[model samples]
Target: MIGTWVSILPPLIAIVMVLATKRVLLSLGSGILTAALLVASFAPVETVKHLWSALTVSFWADGELNTYNIFIMVFVLFLGIITAFVSLSGGSRAFADWAVRHIKTRRGAKLLTVFLGLLIFVDDYFNSLAVGQVSRPITDKHRISRAKLAYFIDSTSAPICVVSPISSWGAFLIGQLALILGTTTAVNYSPLSAFLMMAPMNFYVIATLAMVFFFAWTNIDFFTMKKHEEIAQKTGQLFDPEKEIPGQLKEDFPEHNYGRVLDLVAPILTLVAVTLGMMVWTGYRATQSLNIWAIFENTDVPLSLVTGGLIGTLLAAILYIAQMGRNETASYRLVGKALSTGVKAMMPAILILLLAWSLTYLIDILETGPFLSTVVEKSNIPVNFLPVIMFILAGLMAFSTGTSWGSFGILLPIAGTIMINAAPELLLPALSAVLAGAVFGDHCSPISDTTILSSTGAGSNHIDHVATQLPYALIAAAIASFGYIILGLTGSVWVGLIGVILSIVVLFTIWTVKSRRQIELTT
Candidate 1:
């Protein structure tokens, strides 16, 4: 961090370029080039060399390729394959057909979507795609907008995983906390305990969940959603058929009424069962602990996901292909085609993920985290105001990087160090602020994987999802900031609940006013 402020330039440049151009890949590439140039001491020749090496090497560094990166990518690929196979076999269509029969109303369709989203809490990536695959038709039948469907997918995905104790998100977060805050002498900060303490104070997660239910209950559609719903009603259009669905959204519904609703339910159950079993077994083996939390904290989570994905994918292929044909020979051929097509479909998302990882590595090399910590330590800000400050600043970091996990890695340690060294009692509030801010920012970011996947799943345009969801995410952030301040001032999560209640009330009031205005405008 030789140029302390320069360290911030990479992510800031990424953010600005994204807003200006909407080309996330180009923006990330430019940011990487700028950061690499800075890293190479601003020498032109060295900078070019650094840039080439980054493009060729860092994006798939052997270290990460062998261990962590490969696992994430592999799981995504297999998940894609499973989703594809399920769709081609009429599992998704069959389920939707069954659902629309019973769930005749718009409200029931939306609530069912929400319920399904909440049910698939094992991983956000899995949750987003799975819910979208199953629920899109149901929602479309009931005239729900793609924007609204995308919102439901995005809202439930990350926020639920952030607080879920047994999720991959939780495991990864625990690893970060254990690595960073485990050094403290003042507090015994086991990763699980830290997460537990901050859970109640995670106001944004709670508020976002509440906001979705509000939307479900009241059937509020303001902004672009109103127009979308109108078009859907008039034209029976589920998506913009003219504008291509940009990513791995190849949906060809062949008439395969052979499948039952159980075809969908069975595969999802197999995925869940295999994933949870592997997670527990691996965790227990690693830690030799009967305690589930300890087991979760100790598991080789990334590898477990890969294994689970592989097994679940295999089971899905067997179940789907078996039902697709009269003989095993034909089914085997179908499996081959589906697997190849599905994995290939995921290539776009995989490429984006690779670029994201490369950018994250560059930010880490620039020591951006330490620079941020320096800013916090040097500021003469009051202790109570610090929570709000941390919340806002962390949002900036996550928004820039498009990764809550990366921002969490940077901020959690800094917060812990500050708390132990100067303000011990404010530990819970500060931790809460970091977690809440990271999720809120990533929840809204256009380039974020979760956000991108939500759009991918719903087949909504990415910019549309970003434009529609950002306002709501910002509202959640504002409320979380207020909650953090209350927690800091009162030293109790109970008091912070007041801030949460107020945030929901404000949102509902706005919805009320917006509905009245819509009525007026129509008149």
Candidate 2:
């Protein structure tokens, strides 16, 4: 029972199924089943039966799709409903139309699209749909590919949220930190400070945004993209501009008949304000109750995000109905219809989540993390170079797993423990490395939820987007790796900070030069 063959089979099966069929659910499900079968093969019949029973109970009842899993699904549905209502009331469209009227140039359109992504970091799901839906029309107007729009949306999703301390991601990170800090102490190591510290070190995110800005300002793209832009310019149809909306978008779909932009902008702003205010209030309470904080900190984030999103959506729905001049009671029907449409739009995400969770559970049951960690330790890597090795390992694990949170959950605690033990000074940098690597892998993995949502949002071929994005991610990763080495040796934040800045400047310059040449040729 070496089980060596078992180790490799599941992922191989998953990859083949995904590449061959392009069916995400099938691939993920196949991966889970394969792992289970492998585990069973190694155990005696009686042992196998017991293992199966335990694994099933753990996976279904306490695994990824258990309590928190259900919450995220419900939240996504709620978000969908809110978005649907906003669109139905011409709020979303109104905002888009207004942006179009104000920002006329193609360059400005791309810049504004990126800006929208950064602004909507409250939640990745919201960032995905809101930015995608709002910017699609503008990107179409500028002849930007849906692929590019998806790139912007995907880059902004977790990257922005992870760095923003007040976002849903921020709340979650803070809660996790609180637990690790033993919750009762009023420690200075706030999740907010951690985010701020790492923001400068988040080279991938910073570089990607710089690329977007450079391209928008100069119109430069690498080899094939430039050609695609040229062809789009000549033919006027490189990317399909088809607008798919829940029945709600009909009135504002074409944009010409949409209401004033403020109708949309006001509600969205209100949603942001209310959500942030609630989070602040919740955070304050968590800080005040030492006992309750210790017990509730672990659960606060998902709870808060769901509640905040629901409240924001409720407010949006009210405003939508108010715009229709209907009595509050009469407006229930509109809200109901919008809710139905919204939940329907999120059906795909809901299904994917279940399958993804199942796959994650299977991996955990197989003890993938410990197995992988053992392999890395055996590689005889130097203690000093371990941070760099961990960075690469984190990326590989995340890409294979297709879940950054899973990657972080498995690797962070281990890496943190090891770093603190090895070079106490390197604790923060090592933590940042784990975070960066996880994000990098998630950024490019085709099976990643964020990646899938990005493709769905941009309407790009999933594989193509993954393939195109890999280069950018790898480049940033290479630079980040070098930064990790410098930090490990010098033990100074400035080394990594300077490295990140240099990487962004160099990448942005390349983007600028290529874009300017393309624009001149197009003109």
Candidate 3:
């Protein structure tokens, strides 16, 4: 059961239950318990121990503190506090008022988010949270749904990081590629060169990014997303007030009349600057090298996050304090309230994150990833369909395990080995398909950390984010699958690229026409 088909059941059950009940903690708990039972061979005492270990390991592991998990959790709490402080300082209201006066339209607001998402590609976690902080006020001002904002954040963060050579994702993947290609004497390209070459071949990233811009510029949405957008536009409600919004402040702070846009911009800028600087400094310290790529590859990302978050949080608090004498609304008494509200706002996200991590830990113990990769390894599929098959398998593996990095670790070597032996010419395309599929699946998986953070950043209900984003992800995935098929069959990246572009054009054209007709009918 540990490394066989039975290992797949827990994730499937979790996914199905979450979708059916929309109770994230309960679903994740069920999955965790199921995996623990299986790992403990259905012995009650052993299952309890496994569960305890899983929960404890999130903070303490291997005779030491799990700094990575602790730092990330601390970052989340810091972000929440920053949001509360920003609002208490009247930065949120002031920024939204400024944006409404300048941006003037929903399209401008949405496109602002798109551009911000693209610009912040250093790390997906940072991108997700930062973009939401900047864009949420603007988008909410224009009545864009929280789900839609989450979609924008989710689409831009991972896809951009995966492609950008300077990003944390790029550094990690390059390291993985070095190991994968090191085994082969036939491949002549360096890991960095291979990564750059494979970037254009990642059709899912291309499709997803294109869809993001299309939706941003045209304001077209479908399925659950369309419903969310309509509700927002008609009612001026960003999300259902009744639902659990992970990062939404439970207590509303009074806005200061003298609040300025600088109040909002300064703290966010401080966060981004500090985080990027720390990433380089930490990486340089670790490697003792001046090389930019080497620095990124060895950077302590979680440490950087907490460092930046602490600075940002302090700056936000200072800003509120600075307003004490100038603004009648500002008071020392409200400082404690803001801190408490901020922590309360982030509690839901923290709990969900912990549960998701626990379940992922149990899933790893189950060897679920290897089981899925094993199935792909032993398949006797034709060479022409290998790219598509790898794409699907990688997507499934990532979707089940809720981690694209995990999928990359397990699948890249397998795909490389398979293609190196079967057809060396198709190696890059096959590997690109795996990368694309992992992002696609991660983009859709409810339990994915990036996905959860996107929801948190946008202040949306987690299930709403997952539900609204799924249809769009599936559409992009379908286009990517077609592109992979063409690449595999023709053995040409250019032809495959054309196929992806054409598919997007065709789908967008049809969707546009149908949307116009529906609008005409409504009018």
Leading candidate by lDDT: 3
What TM-score number comes out for model 2? 0.78
How well is each residue in 1-523 modelled by candidate 1, as lDDT tens digits?
4438788888788767877876767887888888887888899998787676666553356545446667867877877787777776777777778888899889998988888888887678778876876787689778887878999999998888888888777877777777767677677767788887777778888888988888887767666676777787788776676643534446454565676777677766776677778878988998898987778777675677678778878877777767644533335666777787778777766776667666666777787756776788789888878778888877877776678888887888788777767687777678778888888888777668788778767867666777788888887787887788788788777888887887689879988998888889999
For model 2, residues 438-501, the per-residue Cα lDDT tens digits are 8888886766777766765554555556655666677778878887787667777788668767
Candidate 3 per-residue lDDT over residues 1-523, each given as its tens digit: 8999999999999999999999999999999999999999999999999999999888999999999999999999999999999899988889999999999999999999999999999999999999999999999999999999999999999999998989899999999999989999878989999999999999999999999999999968888999999999999988999899999998978855877788788999999999999999999999999999999999999999999999999999998899988899888889999899999999999999999999999999999999999987887889989999988998998899999999999999999999999898888889989999999999889889999999999999999999999999999999999999998888899999999999999999999999899889999
TM-score of each: 0.88, 0.78, 0.99
- Between 2 and 3, whose lDDT is larger? 3
Task: Compare candidates 1 and 3 on TM-score and give the better one.
Answer: 3
lDDT of each: 0.76, 0.64, 0.94
Look at candidate 2 and tell me the lDDT of residue 427. Answer: 56
Stronger candidate by TM-score (1 vs 2):
1
Q: State the lDDT at 276 in candidate 3.
A: 98
Single out the weakest 10-residue window by summed lDDT for candidate 2.
245-254
lDDT of 2 at 209: 67
The candidates, ranked best first by lDDT, are 3, 1, 2
